[model samples]
Target: MISIKRFSELSYKEAVVLWNEGFKYYFSNMTMTVDAFIRKLANEGLSPEHSVVAYVDHVAVGFAINGFREMDGKKIAWNGGTGIKPEFRGQGIGKVLIEACLDVYREQGVDLALLEAVAQNERAIALYKKMGYEVFEELVFLQQNGAMTIDAFHTNSNFEIVRGIPEDIQLLEFFQPIKAWQVQVPGCKGAESIIVKKGNEVLAYAVYQRMMDEKHNIQTIALNQCEIKESIDVQKVADFILYHVFQPHHKIKRMVRNLSKNNRLVYNTLLAAGFETLVEQVHMSNRLDQPIKESIQ
Candidate 1:
């Protein structure tokens, strides 16, 4: 028999053990030390009480990491991750965990639940679909190593680009909130934003983070979000945004986090810059408009 327990009941060390076990065969290296695990919870606003772990015969064999945030007056829950030990696969434990997570979401008054899964993970995708989650878009982490050769975005007296905080992007006339969970302001720790304006009208904006070296020189640059008005030349604005966020002068590693493939201009721009797709996932979301008690009970 299987049993589910709130992660709050387990020690961080146990969380690490269960986490490592849950993601043992994941697409990427998800191994976590106790310190890193704690940091993730803190940085991502995940709570032990809101997450769940599975056990069989008192041995933890599965887990789900969930997080909550309020956006646009609606409560949103993110399924940060979910995994089951290889030995425990093919059973109905995963389904039970989903039901438990739904319970958490309902209790927390979540308006919507979102998650991402590796595109190649058919079983997981199918399971999520069965649970009423719909695949909305493809998201990819694009990467480029070594020096960047970015094209300059020319500007006359009418154009100016300036540095700003992540919140500034929201002030733009046509800013769209980033749909990816980790890149949003709440989850994007140490991130900064930039805005380009033609006279007093904003044309484009971007949010990025730089990882510094011991000497404070640029070691890596990461672009999290970029948006341009509908009327602007997307390719040109995208190139310009990359030029600003990536900074062609530095010989450093660079990346774009979980960008939606549907955003053709930005996604294609990254590809044109030789940024290879490092990771690809299917973004899924489930509306929480109905009551969960009937289905869950």
Candidate 2:
């Protein structure tokens, strides 16, 4: 008999074993430790209550982690990760895990669910489509290395940049130039946020986490809201920081960032900067039409 259990019910070792086993099959050379998995869950805001493990006759056969938060007053959930043991393929375990996630979201009053499936994962994409999910956007993961030039407009001596504190960092939000999602670096607690100041006004900012990966992933870069409309000179700023700050400590093999289909700034900038598109993913979302509403007196 197949059954589902919350992630907290399993020991750390069990979760790691299950995760690593599935990852190795789906992704090449992917290895993760128990401590690393636990830390990722915590840092990415994944809770035990949001994860489910599938058990077949008391053996863990599959698992899924769903991370959620309220964005713009709407409950949104992301499928952080999900996998099934190799031996358990074609047994409908994957479908079961997805349903379990939906049930959990329903209980949490989530109006929308989101996940990114690699473009090559045809089976997973078809499964999501069958479950009433629709592809809303295509996200391209790109990477590049070596030093580049900084734009003179941003390099003006009057602008000031400061590293971020934990409290001040929380004010940052995703969907900006630098997404908040990239803050999930392995050991990074708080990221360094650079703010551009002209006189007493804050004009733009970029936040990034130093990645633990050998490539030194510069996780995120968000320009200030006002700078979005102006000629922010992202490439110049990125090139400057990449060469001066990150390149010294690391060889800068590659830096990866995701860009949505509609995001012209980063997508175009990355292309011009010679960051090759390594992979493409479809961003899927499911929303129940005519959501049931409850009235509060």
Candidate 3:
């Protein structure tokens, strides 16, 4: 018989083992130590009360993790991960795991459920579709190394640039409240933001974090969001923001996390700045206002 248990019902060691076993031989290396697993759960706002482990004959075989937050006054839930052991494949456990997630979300009054799947993972994407999830946006992970050659986008406009903490961006009227969960400002604690202003008017903004070496030499920089005011010359403004935020002289590894493909201005700007697409994912959503279809029902 197959059964499901809450992560709270299992010891931390058991939970870690369940996650490792569920994702064993996965397309990506998801194996994690207890500390790393717990840290990830805590950092992502996933709680044991909402996460579950699948068991068969009293042995764990699958797991799902979920997190919740309120955005724009609506409660939203994000599926951090869902996986089943290799030997347990094609046994309907994946569907069970998803249904369990929906139940948890409903219990928590989630207005919408969100998740992302690798673009190439057709099987997983198909399964999500069957579980009432629909892909609404494509997310791309882009990277640029050393210096960028964006001379064509260079401008002589003199906009005052302000450097502030991540919280500062949240206060902006144009701040995007909903996006990929991992790239949200709350998840990017300690990150910085570069706000470009024309006198008193805020024109554009980018949130980023920089890593330094032992000697404090710059290493990697990840820009979580690069938003520009569309009324202005979007391309030119994005170019200016990119040029300033990713100063060409830095010559460090730079990355943008889960940028939406639908966001043409910023996406095109990154492509023009010599950034390459390193990964692609589909952001999916399932509104909970309607009845969620269950296979067994």
Q: Which scores greater on lDDT, model 1 or model 2? A: 1
The candidate 3 region of ten consecutive residues with least summed lDDT is 288-297
| lDDT tens per residue, model 1, 10-126 | 998888988898898788999999999999999988878999988899988898889998876678899988989999998988888888999999899898898999999999999
Better of 1 and 2 by TM-score: 1
Model 2 C-alpha lDDT per residue in residues 119-230, reported as the tens digit of each score: 8889999998988788877777666655433431233333455556433434544224223243322213555555544455444444444555456555433222112223
Q: For residues 208-239, could you state the per-residue lDDT of candidate 3 as single tens digits?
A: 88888999887998988878876656666787
The C-alpha stretches of model 3 lying farther than 4 A from their native spots are 150-153, 290-297
TM-score of structure candidate 1: 0.93
User: What TM value does model 2 have?
Assistant: 0.74
The all-Cα superposition gives candidate 3 an RMSD in Å to the true structure of 4.0
Q: Each prediction's TM-score against the native?
A: 0.93, 0.74, 0.93
Best by TM-score: 1
What C-alpha lDDT do the candidate models reach, one value each? 0.82, 0.62, 0.84
**Number of the candidate with higher lDDT, 1 or 3:** 3
Please identify model 1 stretches exceeding 4 Å from their true place: 150-158, 290-297
